[model samples]
Target: MQIDVLIDVKTTLGEGPLWDVQEQRLYWIDSVDGRVFRATADGSEIRAWQVPQKIGSMALRKNGGAIVALARGVHFLDLNTGDVELINDPEPNLKNNRLNDGKVDASGRFLFGSMDTLEDGPNGALYRLDADLTVHKLQDGIVVSNGPCWSPDGKTFYFSDTWSGEIWAYDYDVEMGSISNRRVFAVLQGENFRSSDGSTVDEEGGLWNAQVYEGKLVRYAPDGTIDRAIPMPVKNVTSVMFGGENLDTLFVTSMARPPLSRFPTDSVQGGSVFKITGLGVRGLPEHRFAG
Candidate 1:
């Protein structure tokens, strides 16, 4: 595998990274600073704007701009002007909670979850937002909600609760956008491994996950078996996504300064984005938010 550094920003808490296919650019957020950054493919030009609140994740919209998940609620973000238009606040009463991770499903629905900011309790929940702006609660009692993706055929759904140290899979309904039969898909086992962070699916339906404190990306077969382990330069590999023209490129994002004083490896470029090519595999295009 060939790894190349895309951006050496070293954001305080670089959590979300989305590839804008139309503009051929990458957009990511630093949650701690509430700043969103846009960069060229080659990292030649970079621009940033401060959002209204802490941005945990975002999805590219089919219409334009991005659907942003923040501490308050979901909103529409204008990439050019950094303007935020509120869509809806799913959890207006939960003052101590915030939306953490989310993605658009095949049926043009948004699936996201909320996490407890204190990180001391199982207070998070997973929810689905339809194209008509209707919201449905799917799962609950999560600590750090993350890594929501689907299979190539949209028949399987995968998600991760970082604090659980495990990943779960469910039988997905394409038309209804529902999931059932939740089972263990993979368990992150290792003394160095802390939790499973963000993930992506390859063309062959292999699940690729970034383990936070492990400093590695574990790609698993559909049968919950280990396929391979790709080591990372940094410990906190936040998220991974498929980008590039043909989706042959795997874009990995990381964190530089976490609250923990310890690290799994001595990586100097901890808060940078990386691209992995020559893996002899490709990833499916990211599903966009239809609304």
Candidate 2:
């Protein structure tokens, strides 16, 4: 496999690499910078818009525009005008909590989780936004939420709490957009221990996770066993997604400024988005938010 910097733009906290199949473009966000970016698969014609608050994730809308999870709550973003209308604040009372990583399910519902701004307590929760624009809380007692994804058959859901050092799997109900039977899918331990930042599933059911602060892309088989681990050029790798014409190229996003004091700020290509080819694998097309 070969990897190289695709976009040289520097972002404070780059996360949420999203591949748009219909539009044949890639979307990503600078979490702490409140910036949303879009570009062709070749990393050209890049366009970025600044949100009013820090952004966690963004989903393409079936009709148009996008649904963005900002620091305050969920909002409908008009990319052309850079106007955002608040949908709802599921945690209006949680002063220290903010919405985080999220993804669209096969049924067109957007599922995302919250994280504590202080990263101190388990003050966060998981939520789902349906097609009717209604929000529902799915799970609670999370510290830092990240990596929301599903299996190929839509039966298994994967999520992680970054500070908890664990990635959990849930039995997902595709039709109802509900999750249950929460269990540990994998633990970050041993010599390779590192926090899970973001993830994407391959067509063959292998989950590729970016191990933040560890500079590695680790793939776990469907059974939660480590399939392989590929070292990254940057130490603060944030997220990954499969883009390109054949959906075989892996797009990676990173961070230039470390969030915590423990991580070094000076790292090679820290904020550059990367492209990986020769993986010999493809990813399923991302689902659009029905709302």
Candidate 3:
């Protein structure tokens, strides 16, 4: 596959690349900077909007605008006016936790998980936002949540707790937007174990993930075997999504600096967005947030 930089904007902690099929555009977030960026499939007509709080993840809305998982709560973001309206905060009591990664389920519900901001313990939980604007708690005791994706058939849900070093799969009920029968799908083993960040499922049910610290894009078969690993130039590849007229391009996001202040970064290409083409596989269209 041919990989190249698509956008050169330096983001402190870039994450959450989203592709809108109907609009044929790409959107991504700089989590620490609380910024949302959008552009055409070719990286043209780029525009950015500042949100009120640090963003974790975002999904396009079925009606318009976007639904963002911000630091304090889930909110509706107005693209034209850049206004943020809070929907609800499921864990307002857990001041040390914040929303992390999220995705829209097949039935148009938003599923996201919270993480312990201190990276110390499992004080976070997963929640589901239904079309009626109600939030339901699903799972709990999570340290750092990331990578909320689904199998092509919508019968399986995949998620990762970065600090736990394992990706888990669950039986998903599409009609009810609930997950059950959780099991470990893959584990990060070996001396060069890479933390899983973001992921997307291909049309063939292959899960493509961005291995954060290892700077590699890895694809895992549905049965949890490594299909391939493509090394990247930067050391902090953060997230990935498929976008293009035909959804054949793999768009990646990276981080210029570490999440914590104690760490230092040195890669010059670290915060740029990259796209990989020439791969034979394509991806399913992302589901929109129904609410």
Every model's TM-score: 0.95, 0.97, 0.97
Backbone clash tally (model 1) = 0
RMSD of each: 1.7, 1.2, 1.2
Question: How far in Å is the alpha carbon of 189 misplaced in model 3?
Answer: 3.4
Model 1 lDDT per residue over 84-147, tens place: 9998888899898898888888878999989898776888889898888888989998988999
Best by lDDT: 2
- As for model 2, its CA RMSD to the true structure in angstroms is 1.2
lDDT string for model 2 (1-291, tens) is 999999988989999999998999999999999999999988899999999999999999999999999999999999789999999999989888899999999999999999998877999999999999999999999998999999999999999999888889999999999999999998875354468999999999999999988888899999999988998888789999998899999999999998768666647688999999999899989999999
Question: Using alpha carbons, what is the TM-score of model 1?
Answer: 0.95
Residue 70, model 3: lDDT of: 97
- Model 3 residue runs over 4 Å out of place are 190-193, 261-264
- Model 3 Cα RMSD, 1 decimal: 1.2
